[model samples]
Target: MELNLKRQIGIFCVLLILPALCSAAFTKSRATFYSTSDGLGTPTGRCGYGDYGRTVHGGSVAGVSNLWRDGVGCGLCYQVRCTNPSLCNSNGAYLVVTDYGAGDRTDFIMSPAAFSSLGVNSTANDELRKLGTVDIEYQRISCSYPGQNIVIKIKESSTNPGYLSIVLFNVGGTCDVIAIQLSQSGSNTWVSLQRVDGAVFQISNPPSGTLRFRFQVNCGSGLEWRLPKNDIPANWRAGATYDTGIQF
Candidate 1:
């Protein structure tokens, strides 16, 4: 009977240790995400943060129904998975996550259905007024800029896929969609300035705050993206660059 008691104690001890071992293993197993080393996400827009080419899901790209919100069209959002899943309702209107915000949480934001319509991802069309935003609290903050005759260059990485807001400014005030141009080797290519009627352009970066802009080139797939300004800011970042991606 004592031997049996000892055996039972040994079994209990093993069971107790199993949970600890499993928990330790889980803690050690790190999820490979593309971002800064600090783990605090980008203060502003920065490119080459995540591997867009990689399959977010099992052997497939995580399809998002929408990205940007505001002044968008009305439609039913599809494929876009909600971190909360319930954040989206039956109505066509939902906040589309354009670029990843600077925060650490993974949330799916909705929009005024109108904002959803104009985006390239929008599909269904309905009454514009009915599709207005439901959740107004979750707004994205990122670096906005619009480039012009000023000579500049950005290097893109495989993780960058042009998901940012471009603005323009100097000592003067800044404007939205005022002007922007994307080129290859200082020459117009793929999406030349002439081809893109507007001044603003789309880029990949974090939301909120001022980021000293670092031009990203050929991010992984030979595309352009943005990176944190390794340098200091010239101004308080009074304004932003043009947003060409704001499809009229």
Candidate 2:
């Protein structure tokens, strides 16, 4: 009886420890900063997102290189804090991966604005010149924290009924959309959507009916949105398309 009680205590202790382990998913790395014209054009990045101003979570933006998994890293958010305690903020800044760079051996490349926003310096250029680079820690965070989520829209191609154009918008949190799938009405099976570019997915010969979309985010989470059957245009004709606005 004593042995069983001890085993139960051990199991309870292990369960108590698990949440801490799950929360500490951070990595240590070096970081640098860049500005808009630092000889790098307004990069559309691998994730195919346009340049927004710095100041994510009220902090500046970060440009990561080696971490860029094509465009998969585009819309994900990260919490970055300087390793140098004196240079770091009590609350590290939040940043989104909007661009990529030719990463140095370091782990992150911050936009000039992002670096300055971290209280590293008054200006990104000044921080770049003063620090050149710095040590930092980063970890992935959920997209829902920002109260935004991925939005998918579908449009019929003007030229072909077999080709459907899908676009993503208001991509908050997950960083980038890696995989997309569609389900036709009356079918439990899901069909994969092909990437035509950063912003577009193509479904060839899509069925005529209501469809559902599933987006696999870069952070290993999945989001789903469905369009009701009646929402689909009747007799989907060639060159005809419909747009389903933002969905969860």
lDDT: which candidate is best?
A: 2
Best by TM-score: 2
Compute each candidate's TM-score over C-alphas: 0.19, 0.63
Model-by-model lDDT, in order?
0.24, 0.54
Q: What TM-score does candidate 2 reach?
A: 0.63
RMSD of each: 21.6, 10.3
State each candidate's clash count: 64, 8
lDDT of 1 by residue, 38-112 (tens): 322222321121221121111111112223222111111122221122333222222212223221222232223
Model 1 residue 57 lDDT? Answer: 15
| Per-residue C-alpha lDDT of model 2 across residues 23-83, encoded as one tens digit per residue | 6557888887765655332445444433332323333556677666765565555667676
Candidate 2, residue 245: the lDDT equals: 47
Candidate 1 lDDT score at position 146? 28
